[model samples]
Target chain A: MIITPIDSTAPPEPTPTPTRTPTPPASSASVRRSRLGRTLEPFGFIAPTALLMLVLMIVPIVLVIGYSFTDNVILNKNPEFVGIENFVTVLTDGVFATAIGNTLVFTVVSVIAHLLIGLAFAMLLNSPLVSNASRAVFRVIYILPWLFTAAVIAVLWRMLLSPNGVVNYLLSSDLEWLSSPALALGAVTFINIWAGYPFFMVSLLAGLQGIPADLYEAATVDGANGVQRFFNVTLPQLRPIIISMTLLDLIWTSQQFALIWLTTGGGPINVTEMLSTFTYKLAFSRYEFALASTSAVLILLFSMVLAFFYVRHQRARD
Target chain B: MSKEAHGRRRTLRVLGASAAAVALFATAGCSASSDSGSGDGGDVTLEFAQWWEPELPDGAFRELMDEFEAENPGIKVELLSGPYASTKEQLFAGAAAGTMSDVVGLDGAWVSDFANQGAIADLTALMAESDYDDSELASQIQVDGATYMIPVVNFVYPMFTNDDLLAQAGVAAPPADRSEFAAAANAVAGLGDNTSGWILPLSLEAPNGIQNDVMSWVWATGGSMLDGGQPDVTNDEVTSAVEYIKGLWDEGAIAPGAFTMKEQDKVEEFTNGRVGMMIDSLAHINLIRETNPDLKFSISALPAEDGFDGERGIPYASWGIGVAESSEHPAEAWKLVDFLMSEETNAKLSSIANAFPGNTESVPDFVAEDELFATAFEIYQNGYPANEFTGLPVAEQLMRLFDEQFQVLLDGGQSVDEMLQKTQEAWLAEF
Candidate 1:
C-alpha cells in the first residue's frame, strides 16, 4: 500500500480569521515620512564605509594626481604647475621604456609559470590514488615557499644563487646569476615564480575538489583518457578560478619592488628595472617627486584597465 | 516603534559612532603632537636622529648621550637611531614636512642637497652666534662657501691586504705603485680555487662604491676629478684610472660579480679570506677581525700611479653633524654638536668606534694600542684626505651614473672615452 508523506517542515495553512473592530487610517504626513525612511535606511548602513573610503583612498589618489602636474614638488618649497610636462619627461625616458619591457616579461612569464606549476601540483594532490595522510604532508611541503616573507625569500635565493653558492656547487658552474646583465631578469622572475605558485596551488586545489565526481565518472564511462578528462572536464570546471587567479597574480607580480630591490636593485645597467623601481628611484633616490607621481599615475591607469577586465570576467561568471 | 522613528534612531546611532571615531582620531593626533614637543617643567627636549648609534659599540652612544644630559641639566636628548638608508629616508621625509629633528647625523653627499633645499642650518652662522671655536676641527663640509656640516669622526678608505695571500703569491710587500699592484693582483688571481686579486663593489644601489673603490685609485696619486670645483670626469687623470681598471677586468684579476657587489659583500669576501686585497674603510677592520680572527691582514695606503711623487690623497668618509633649519631648539642642538666635536668627547667616540678623531688635536688611544690603527694613523698623517664627491650636488646620483657607464665599459659595451664623455654630460645636467 502507498503511504502519503506528511509535510511537517512546511508552515500550516492560515485559519479563517474572526471579524474584528476596524482601526483608523494613518495621516498622509506619517505615510510620506515612513516612505522616505524606507528609502534612506540602506544608505545609513553604508555611510561609515563610504566616508572611510573617501578619506583614505580617494583623497590620496587626488593628491597624487595633483602633484603629477607640478614641478619638483616635495623638494621645492613653492612648486610651479607644469601641466603634462612631467608625464612627457617620464614617457620620453629610455630607462622607463626598458622598465616597461622588463615588467611585461617578468609579469607574463611569472603568471604563466605559476599557473602551470600550481596546476600540476594540485592535480597530483587531488589524485584518487593519493592517501589522505600523504596528501596532507605533500600539501604542506608545496605550500612552504609561500610562507616565507619577501625579504627572507630574497636573502635565501641570493645565497643559493651566488656564484660560489650551493647552486653553483651542485652544478659545477660559476654563473653570476644575479649580476649578469643577460641573466638577471630571468633569475628574478624565476624567484618570483617560486615564491608565488603556492597561492595558485591552494586556490586551484579547492576548485578541483569542488568539481563533482559524477562528471569524471561520466567521462571515464564515455571512454575518455586521463588527459582527455582533464581537458574536457577538470579544466572547464576550474576555468573561473583560473582566470581570477591569473589576473590577480598579474597585478601582484607587476608591482613587485622589494624583492628586486633587495636582489639585483635593477642593476647591471637597468636590465631588471621594473616600473615600480623606476618610480621609486625617481621619488626617493633622485628626489624628482613630480616625475615619480606621473609614473605612478600611469601605472594606476594600467592597473585600472586590468581591474576592469577582472571585474567584467567575475560578473559574467556570476 | 513606527518606521520613521526607527529610521531616525538608526541614523542618530551612526552619527554618534562617527563622531566618536573622529574624536578618537583627533585625540590621538593631539597626543602625538604633544609627545613630539618640548618636555615637562620647562626642560627642552632635542630629538637627535642618527645612524651612528647602531654602528658604534652597543650602548656606547647612549652613554655619551647620558653624559651630555648630566652636563646639561635643562636640555634632554632623545635618540632616534636606525640604519643609514632608513635614517636618510626618515630625515628626508622630515625635511619635506618641516618636522626634522633638532640634531641630525649627515653624510657629506647629503650636505649639498640638503643645503640647496634649505633643509639644514648654516653651521658657520650657528657657530659664530654661539661663539664656538672652529680652529681644532680637521675639516668642514661646505656648500657655496657656507659650512653646513661638521665632521665628528673620520674613517678613511685604505688598502687592506691579506698578508698570507700576498706571501703565497711571492709578493714581498703591498704594492707601492699601479704597475706593481697590477702584477701582484694577476699573480694572486693565478692561484686559482675561485680566488681573485681584488673585489670592486660597483653596485649602483649604493654607488658610494664608485667613490670609495674606483675614484680612490685616481685620488691615490694626488689626481683630481674636479677642475675649479666643476666635474672633469673626461680629464686625463680619470681616463688613466679607468683604463687601468679596465685592463685589470680584462685580465680577470677582479672578483666575479663585481658589477652587483655591495660594500658589505666586499667586506664579507675579504673577511672570509676569498680575496687577496680590497680598498675598504678602516671602520671595517674591527668587523673583519671579529668575523674571522684567524685571518691575517694589514692596512696600507692605496697604491699611487707610477712615476708620481706627491702626497697621496686618502678617500675619507665622516660621521657629520648638523642642525635642522626647522628645529625649535637650535641652541640646544648646537650645544650637542659642540660637545660631540670637543677634543675629549671626539677622542672617546673615535676610540670606541675604531675611527680617527675629527678634532685634529685629539688623539685616540687606539693609535698606540692597536698596531692596525697605528698604521692607519701613519697613513692619515702622511696623506691628504680627499673625496671629490663630497659637497657635490646629487653626489650619490653622480656615482650611480658613473657606475652604470663603468659597468658598460668593463663589459666591453663602450670605450673608456665614450663612457667618461657620457658620464660627464649626465653629471653636467645634474649640476
Candidate 2:
C-alpha cells in the first residue's frame, strides 16, 4: 500500500544523472551498504499496510466473489454454484435501476457539497483574522460530524427533519419533506454532508496547513494578489488530498443505507431507495438473497469502474 | 539489506501481521453456552427461538417453561428473541438453509407458506397424540390440505369499547351491527371536545392501532383481505368493505393521527380517555389493563352486517409451536411443546400471558371462569378466523392504499365506486 505512494509520479523527477548520482568515492563497500539499505527501506515502511490490506480487505473480497457465483442458502444446505445468474437478475430488475439512480444522485451531490464547503472552511480557518485558539475551537466543532454514529446521526437528522420535527418546527410548515420525492434526495444528501463534511474539513485543513508558508510568502512577495496566491499555490498543494477525499466520499456516500433505512425505509413510493438500502430490503425484508447478491455484484462492478477511472486519473495527474 | 533480503522481510512482516489479525477474528466467534447450570441428566440444551426478544410482560410463558423443565428434569430451554422486523427473515433463512432451532413459533396462517417451502415440519401426528382436538387445529395447521404449524395460543381481534364514553353519548350497547356502530361513533364522539367518533389506526406502520381497529370493521362487513383462493386483492367484496369504511369516514368518526399513529397509540389513547374506543388483539387484555386498571372497557364482536351468517369480527391468526427438523432430540422437543401446550400448563401459561392458550381446557377455564377474558373469548368463538396470509409480502402497500382511498371517500371528494375500482385494480395487479 505504501509503495504505491511512490509509484509512477513525476517521471522520476527528470533525473540529471551525474549531478544526482550517489557519491561513492569513500569506498565500494560503503556504496554497497547504502544500496542494500535503500532496497529494504520501502518494505520497512509499507509492510504493515500491505499486511492489513491483504487480511482485512483482500480476503473478504475473494470470499464474497466466490459466494456470488454460488447458491449459498447460508443456513440449511451447502451452497452450490449457479454462476452469473444472480448478477443477471439484478441487472434486469427495474428496482435495482431505481436504487442505482438514487445512489448516484446522493453520492455526486453529497461529495461535491462536502468538498466545496470543506475547502471554503479550510480557507476561512487558515485566515489571519481567526485567532489560533478559536481555530482550535473550530477544529473541535468540526469533529462533531465525525463523532456521531451513523444511526444516531440518522435519527437526529430524522427528528430535526421530520414533518413534526424541529426543522418544520423552526420553519413552521407541515410539509412532509421526507415523503416528497423532490425533496427526499436532497434531505438524505443534507444528512450525508452534515455527518461527513467534518472529515473533509479536517483532512483539507491538515493538507492546507502542510503547504509551505514560503511558497505563499514568495507569491505574495512577487506582488501576487490574494486570489492569485490561492490559485497558484494553495490549490495546487491541495489537489492530491482533494482528489483522494472525493474518491473516498464517492465510495462512502454511495453506500449510505442506515440513514435512509431508519428515516424512510425507502418511503412513500420507493423514492429514496438507494442501492445499499434496496439490496438490504431485498436480501432481508423480502428474503430475495439471490437478487440481493446480484445487486451487490452490480454495485461492486460500478464502483470498481469508478475506482479504475479515479486511479487512472490520479496516475495521469502524477 | 540486499533485494532478496528486503523482499523476504516484507513478506515475513505481512505474514506475521496477517496471522495476528486472523487470530483476533477467530477469537471473537466464541459464545458462552447458556445451558451451563447443573443438570440431573448432565445438561441437555434446547435452543428456543422466537420473534419476541424480551418475553411478554405476562408471566405465564415463563411459568410454563419452568414446569416443562421440572417435568423433564434435565432438559433446559434457552429463549432467543430477535429484533422485530427481520427476525422472521432470519428464521426463514435459517429454516431454508437448515440450521433452525429445536422449536419455533410459526404464525398459524402462514403454515401453508412455510409448509410449501418445506421450511417447517409437519406436526399432524404430534397433534393426534396430544389432548388438543385435531379438527379445531384446522385453521392454523391444515393449510393447503396438510398440517404444518402447531398452535401455542390463539388471540382474537375484538371491538374494545369505552363504556363510560358510550354512556356519555346516551348509548346502551357499543354497537351491534354496521349501522349501529357508525351511529354510535358519531354520538359518542359528541362527548369529548374536538373528539372523533373512533380511533382506528390509519397507518400501515407498526403498532398501527387505528388501521387494525378499522380492519375489524372491514372484515365484519364480509370482506376478506384476499380474494377466494387467490392473492389478487381487487374485488367487489373488498370494494364494499372500502365503501363501508368511507361511510364511517364521512360520518367523521376517525381521529386526526389515526392514519399515522403507531399501533399502541390507539390502545393508549382510549385507555387514557383520549378516544371513545379502540379495536385490537384480545391478547392485549393484560397490557391494556396495566395502563389504567380503573378504566372501564368491554370486548364485543365488531358490528356485523344486518344479517350475515358468520360472526362479524375477525380472530387474529393463531400461533403454533413445532419441533425443528434438525433436532437430534425430536422427542424431547415435541415433549416440551406438548407439555407447554398441555391443558394444565396451557391454562397456566394463558393466565400469565393474558392470552388464549391453545389447550381447550385452558381456554374454557379462562373464558368461562376468568372475568377479564370472558368477553374476548366469546368474541373469539363467534368470529371468523383471520387468515394466515391476510397481510402478505405487500401488506404495507395494501394498508396505505386502503387508508388513502378511505380518506378520499369520506371527504366526499371521490365516489366510493371510483375509489374501489382504482384501488382494487392496483391491488390485484400487485400480486
Candidate 3:
C-alpha cells in the first residue's frame, strides 16, 4: 500500500517519441492554389461583363450561324434545315459579289481618308502651337460630326449633295451627286469619311499624348524634319493605335447600314450596295432570312479575321 | 474625426446607395410591368397596332378609339402608331414573338402574304357577319377563298398640277393627253433651272411609290405589271411606257432630283412651287393646301398617251385591319375591326386620313369639297387595286425586283428593253 502511494504521487516518465515539426504553415501546392485563387479574384469581378458578352454577342452569332443553314424565311413559321443550300445560293448570287466589291471599295477608301484626316487633326491638336483653350474648342468642333447620329448625317449630306442643293450651289456646278450612278457611292463614302474621321481623331489624339516627348526631341536632334520625325518616331509609336483603329474602322464601314440605307438604299442601280445594306434588304425587304443570315455569317467571318489581327497584336503586346 | 464617426459615415453612405439602387430598380420594374397592363382601369386590355401618322392629323382615329372604348366598357385599347415602316416592323417582330397586337393595320398588298404565312388570322367568319364581306375592296384581302382582313382606307395615285405654273408657262391646266403633258412639262422646265416641268417619283423607296408613279403609265398603254401572277416587265405596253419615261428624262422635263426624291420630297417640291406638275397620291392635297395656301393646284387623272383617249388607269393602294393568329382576345379584336369598317367610323377616318373609305358606300361628304378628292374618288372607281403581287408569297421580293430594275432604268444606266428583260428573267427565275 505504501509503494502504490509513492507511485501515485510521482509523475510519469516521458516516452521516447520523435518530435513532429510544426506543420510548415501550409503546403506549397496549397500556397499555389491560394495564389491562383487570388489571381482569379479579379476575374470574378469581370464575370458579369463576360457573361453579358457571351449571351449578347456569342449567342447571337451562334444563332445566326444556325439560321444560315436553314430555309428561314420570315413568313415561314418553321425553318427547314437546308444544309449548305443557303450558302450556295448566296455565293452563287451575282448581287452578293457586287455587294462584296462595294463593301471592299467603301472600306478601303473611307478608312484611308479617315486615317489621313484624323491624323492631320490629331497632329495639329497635339502641337505646341495649340493653346489648351483653343485645343478644347477645336476638339469639340472637330468631334461635332461624330456626335451627330448616322441618320441625321446621312439626311444632311443627302440634302447638301442634292442636285439643286447647297453643295451644287456653292460649287456653281449642276452636278447630280447622290442620284448619279457614277457618284452616289463616292458621295456617300465622302459623307461617311466626314462623319467617321472624328472618332479616329479623338482616339489618335489621346494616343499621341501618350508618346514620350523626349523620343520626339531626340528624333529632331537626330536631324529628322517634321515628315521624317512623323514617319520614324510618331507613326512607329502610333502603330498600335493605328492598327487597332484601322481594324475597327474597317468593320464599321463594311457594316455601314444607316448611312447607305438612308442615302442611297443600295440605289442608283445597286452601285452602292454594301454587304450590310444588302443583308438588311434581303431580310426586311425580300424576307429571305436564310440568305441574309448566310450573308451576315460571311460578314462576321470577315470581321472576325480583322478582329483576330487586333487581338493577336494586343496579346503579343501583353 | 473619430474612427467610430468615420465608420458611421461610411455605413450611412452604403445605406443611401442601396436605397437609391432599390428605388431605381423599383421604377424600372414598374415601367416594365406597366407595358403589359391597361392604361385605364379595365378587365381586359387589347393592343391595336396602327400606322397612324403622328405628323399628320390623326384626331379622327383618336375619336374612333374613344367611341369604341365608350361602347365597350370592359375592354381597353392601347394604340401603337408610327411611320408605316416602323409600325410594320413592330408588328412583324411581335408576330414572330407571339406577342403581336390583337388587331394590326397592314398594307392591303401584304394581306395575302401574311395570310399565306398564317401570321394573320382568317377573318372569314367575322367578315361574313358584316355587310362588307362581299365588297370589291374586301375581295382584295381574300386569299385562297378566305377573307383574312377588312380593308379600311385607300389612296389613288393621281397627278397634281400647279395652276400658276401652268399659266406662267402658257400651258393649260389638267393636261388632256400625253402630248399636252409633255408640252406643259417642257414649257415649265424651260421656265427656269430651279423649276421643273414635271416631277415623277422615280425613287425606289417603296414599290408603291415608283410602281404607282410609273405603272399607271404602263397601264394607260394597256400594259400590265403582272400577267397571270407573273411579271411581264418586257411587254409592249411596259416597253412603250419605259421609252416615254426615258424620253422625259432625256428631254429634261423631269425634276433634277426626281430620280431620288421620295414622295415627301416630291410634295415639298410641289408645295414650294419648284415643280409645275407632280405625280403623287391624293392624300397630299390637304398637306399641300396647308403648306401653301396661295399655291393654286388641281388634281386630275394621269394623262394618257397621245393617240390613246384621255381615259386613264389609276393605281390605288390600301391598308386593312386584321387579327393576329396568336391573338388571345380575337373576339374583342373583331369588335375593333367591325367598328373601323362601320359607315360612320369609315367616313370619319377617311376624311381625316384624306383617303377613300373601304366601304364604298361610306365615302366621306368632305370628299366632294374639293375637285381633287372628287377626281380621286372618280378614279377610285376604275382603280385596279394596285395589288400587283396579290397571292404571290414573294410579294415583297417581286416588288424589290421591279424596284431594282426601275432604278437602273431611271439612272440611265441601261435601256428599257434590257432592263425589262432582265427583270422578266429574274422574276421568272424566282417564281
Candidate 4:
C-alpha cells in the first residue's frame, strides 16, 4: 500500500537509523527553548523544499490526473467527472496511436545514437594525454547547444536547413533540405541528437572516471585489447547509469515538441507529431481540454513505469 | 566559541544578501516595463498582447508607443508580440488560464469563435450605443448572425500587373476576361529569360489570397461557395475554377519555386521584375512600391470570363480589433474602440500607421490619389468571403488539406481525379 517503486528489487537496507545521535546540551532557562529549536531545526531546514514541491509539482500533477477523468471543454463552467471514459477514448483514438508510434520511434533513434556517440566522446575527453586547453575548448563547444534556448536552437537549425537559406547559399543550389519528405524526419532527429548528446557525454565522462582505472589495468594485463577492455570492464560498470539515462532520455524526447513544432509545425502530413505535440495541438489549437489532458495523463502513466524502473535502478546502485 | 561561530554565520548571511541585492539591482534600471502593473493615476500602463510582426515588441511600433506615452500624461502601453504561428495557441491558453489582455487583436475570422466561447465581447450593442458606423466595419464581422467585432484596417486582395510587360506583349490592357487572361499567358509565355510571364502562388498556403482568387473565378462564373448559407464546392463553377487553376499549374506559367516561396519570396520575385503578373495583399502595396517606386507595376482586378454580369470581383479579407469578454474594464475598452473608429482618430492612425482607414465616409478621400487603394476599394465593394466550409477552429485542418493537397496536385503526385476525391474525403472527415 505504501507503493515504494522498488518493492521487490530494493532488497533490504543493512540497518535502520541509529537512535542516539548527539545533541548539544544547554543550561536551565534557555535550555528548553533551545531543545525545542534543536528538535525542529531539521524540519525548518526541509520546509522550503517540501512546500515548493507540494504546491508546484504535486498539486499540478494531481489536478492533471483529476482532469483526465472529467469533461473539461473550454466553455464548461464546471468539469464533469466521467470515470475511465477519457482513457477509453484515448485508447481507441487513431491520432493517439499515431502520436505514440512517432514518439517512441523518435525516442529510440535519438537515445541510441546519443549513448554510442556520447560514450565515445566521453572516453576521448577522459583520456589522460588530452591537453587541458583542448579539453576546455571541446567542452565549451559541446555544452553550447545545451546552453542555447530550445527555441533559438530550433530557429537556428531552421535557418540552416531552409530551402533557399544559408545552407543552400553556401552550396549554391536549392538543396531542398527540409521540403522533401524523404530527408525531413532524419533532419529533425539529427538536430535533436546534436543538441542532446553533450549532457549525456559529460555525465558519461563522470561515470567513466568513477570506474576504477585499476580494473582496466588488470584487464590490460590479462592481454585484453582496448575495445575488449571497454566491453568487459567498462560496460559492466556503467550498466546502471546507462539504464537510468535511457529512461530519462525516453521521457525527455517523448515530451519534446518545441523543436519539432518550431521547425516543421508537424507538417509534411503530421510526420513530426509526437505524443507531446499531439497533446499540445489538442489542448490549445483544438480547445479540446478533456482530450488533451487524457493524452497528458497517458504520458504520465507511461512515465510512472519509467519512473519506477529508474528508482529501482538507482536504489540497486545505492 | 559559539558566539564567534554565530558572528561568522551572520557575516556570511550579510555577504549573501549583498550579492543577491547586487544581482537584483543589475537587472533593475535596465528598462521599466510599461505593462508590469497599473502605476499610480499619473501613469496608467496598459499591456497589449498581439502577434503582429511589423508591430513586434521593439520595432516600428515601439517608437510610436514612445510618442503615445510622451503625449498622454500617464497612459503608457506595453506591447507583447508573440510568435506569429502560435497566436492561436496563446489566445486559447489565454482563454483557459484567464491571462488575456484588456485589448486583443485577432483576425476578423476569429471574432465569432472567441465571441461564442464567451472570450470576446458583443460589439453590436456597443456600436449601436456609440457613434460607430456598421458600414465601416469589415464584411466578416457577423458570426451566427450576430455583430460582434470592431473592424480595424483591412488587407484585401488586389491583382498586380507588370504594365511594362503587358505593353510590350501588345496586350492593350490587363485582361478583363478569363479567356483573354488564359490567352495572355500563352502569348506571354516566352517573353524573355528574365520573364516568367505570369505568377500566382501555388501554395495557397496563405489561403486568404487563394480564396480571394478562387472566389473571383467562382463569381466570374456566377457561382458562390455557399447556397442557403452552406458550402457548395461540388457546383459546376467551383469545379471549373479548380480546373482552371490546375490548368495554370499545367501550363507551367507560375514561378518554379512558387510552392516553396514565403510571402517575401513571392514579392521579391515580382519586385525584381521577373514576374509579369502577381497577386498580393493590399497591405503589401507600400512594400512593393518601396522596393522600387520607379517600377511601372500597377494594380487591377482578377479578370473575369464567365460571369452572369460579364465580370467578377475579388474576395476580400479584413482585420479587426476586439475586447476580451473577460476584460476588467469593458467600458474603457469600448471607449477605445469608439475612439479608434472616430474620424479624427481614424485620420491620426491612418496617417501614422500604414493602416487603411476604416471609416467609410472618409476612405474615398484617403484613396482618391492612390490607385492601389482605388483597386482594393473596388475589390472590397464587390468582394465576398467564400463559405468558411468548416468552423474557424475546426477549419484549420480543412485549410491544411487544401494547402497540402494543392501542393500534391501541383507536383503531379496525384491525378486531378484522385486529388478531388481525396480533398473531399479529407474535408468530410475534418468537417
**Best TM-score goes to which candidate?**
1
Worst 10 residues of 4 chain B by lDDT: B384-393
Task: For residues A5-106, write the lDDT of model 4, one tens digit per residue.
Answer: 766766787786779765566545576865775575555555545655766699878888888888865546577889999889888987678778878888
Estimate the TM-score for candidate 1. 0.93
What TM-scores do the predictions have? 0.93, 0.73, 0.86, 0.75
Evaluation by DockQ, superior candidate among 1 and 2:
1
Structure candidate 4, residue pairs in collision: B178-B304, B220-B307
Here the TM-score of candidate 2's chain B is 0.80
lDDT score, candidate 2 = 0.67
lDDT of 2 at B381: 62
DockQ of 2: 0.11
DockQ for each model: 0.33, 0.11, 0.18, 0.10
Rank list by lDDT: 1, 3, 2, 4
Q: Rank by DockQ, descending?
A: 1, 3, 2, 4
Top candidate on lDDT is 1
By lDDT, is 1 or 2 better?
1
lDDT of 2 by residue, A1-318 (tens): 223466665567765566666667769787787677667666655655665677678876776677677773443246678988877777787767888788888899899999988898888898879999999999888778889888898667755764445777688775656645457677777888888888899899999889989998899899999999989999999998898889878987888877777665664345577898778765653445555666777788888877987898789888
- lDDT per model, in order? 0.91, 0.67, 0.78, 0.67
lDDT of 1 at A78: 100
